[model samples]
Target: MKPSLYIATALMLASTSGFAQRPPAISSPDVHADNTVTFKYYSRTAQKVSLSGEFLSGNHAMTKDTSGIWSITVGPVKPDIYPYAFVVDSVPVADPNNTYIFANERFKRSIVDIPGNTPLVHALQKVPHGKVSYRLYPSKTLGTTRQLLVYTPPGFNPAGKTKYPVLYLIHGGSDTEETWTKVGRANFIADNLIAQKKAVPMIIVMPYGNVRPAPMPDFTKEVMQDIIPFIEANYPVLADPQHRAVAGFSVGGGQTLNIGLTNTSKFAYVSSYAPYTQTEEFQKNFGATYAPNAEQVNKQLKLFTISVGTDDFLYESVKQNIAMFTAKGIRLRSDIVPGGHTWMNCKQYLATTLQGIFK
Candidate 1:
């Protein structure tokens, strides 16, 4: 109607449009100098909130303050990276204030890093870094294009005359290809290990191991047929079995047993970490097809190792597998450590594998 009246009304509306009523910013996963961590979550209407993480023995209840913020400070935790989540009224949720996440298909958890005085193997250190590249490859077995991550060692050159060994690494069930690099910090571990001359420079191929809706066993086919050929063709890696290795964690670890043991001529190094072998495919292969040809398999494989944490749920099964291999006169190295089935142990297993493989 009137110019001055319209301007006055616009200003009045803008002032009441809820911008200034926004809640204050909250910081979560605050790591203290003493290695203790403070986790915070903002919720006013929640009945209860609790914290669950690898660092703690059990879920710890969080106290709510007047500002609708629920928080708990736990641990002078042993300096390492851990995945934690807040259970708000029985529902697990990632910290809204923390951006670092645990890369998995089934969990929405946030990551917290408590740095040690010395850099952890998975920690980013002042060393020559490797490049993690995401690449798409055609999966003839799966009948689609799939994505995978490749970690090339520092100073990698495509046209260079030097060729590197290849490690076909796989992730756990419900974990994506990026889990190895993102959650497990495989690239950083490799960087630190290579810089220290503990491990040789090599190429690592992390492929998506889930082929659900399709038979779970088909993943072994994809890795053997599609993924291996793609990496060998594209990267300057040695193609022979002597220079090729296969390793994985959880369900992927079971696949490692299937793919590596059944095809011992293809993979010289087979490292399975806390493998979940209670699968139909694992039984079908290890029971029928495997037939305990331990002598021949032992001859073909240069290194066969299985690692498991004592507190892992699958520890008994893994120990049984180790015993079976030992009884069959197959040479195997067992790395039994203290901890559960977690990415923390995965990093330890990988660091050890890097040191042992391709030597």
Candidate 2:
């Protein structure tokens, strides 16, 4: 009850609490000057921990230390945004120490941005950046409330009279509207291109492109009906075919070929990256319409591009697609690169396609 005695007791308790056991320190993701990144996962009870990502060879087994920390050093990775995760005891998990995250398709992962000596096309350069926003709209065809990620280019003012061109960018199978921006880094690519004045400042709209198992209404219905109407009414964008473009990867690439080719009057620029479609399915679906609309479609469409990697699963089919359509008295542009059906190639395809679209 005495003041001095109570103060001494409080000090002793504070010392005990301060000296109480504390969490161990972490030395994860040690970035070296040579660009090699070493990642560490400390777990005293885990049986196994491995690292896999946009970097490294598939999955690399990390070495465990005496202190129960698993670690691996990979790359000299080229300066780019890479997503990686640590698999602990057969469960895939993001690194807890990393603050940057890129999530899509309902799965979240950690990201690391390695800066290059000079800015890459996909790099986020020091320039006026754009704004990415989410707009939830009612999809009457799908009978669901769908979300779309819209990117307005740098210096975009909705009130101003400057109306920008629009690009309806679509995502692949098992991916959502957010995939293009989050994982593909489409916004930064667009920002860099616009800053360099290689591509025009345009409004990019990324929409979900999965409507599957057949007999179901194709997503093209929603794309043509709900999404276009919403973007046109809300944003300061050009509303004509001359200022509109459509592009996607994988399944979305197929949709691009189907919708953009079939509705050529609506989209002047169309690009498909590693589009997945069987010849039989293509014939059953778009063949009849393609033959009849050939002249009109060709007349209306300014640019029609198809790109696929050499190692892509859809490579042969895409080549056949290019050949089949070209033989159908249609003009086509095909870009075959050196990679597989991965996001790495998709990003490059996007960058190249953007530079050519509005020009």
Task: Give per-model TM-scores.
Answer: 0.92, 0.87
Collision pairs in model 1: none
Cα miss at 22, model 1 (Å)? 6.3
lDDT of 2 at 74: 87
Global lDDT for candidate 2? 0.83
Best by lDDT: 1
The 0-to-1 C-alpha lDDT of every candidate, in the order given, reads 0.90, 0.83
How much is 177 displaced in model 2, in angstroms? 1.4
RMSD of 2: 6.3
Clashes of each: 0, 0
345 Cα displacement, candidate 1 (Å): 0.8
Could you give me the TM-score of model 2 versus the true structure? Answer: 0.87
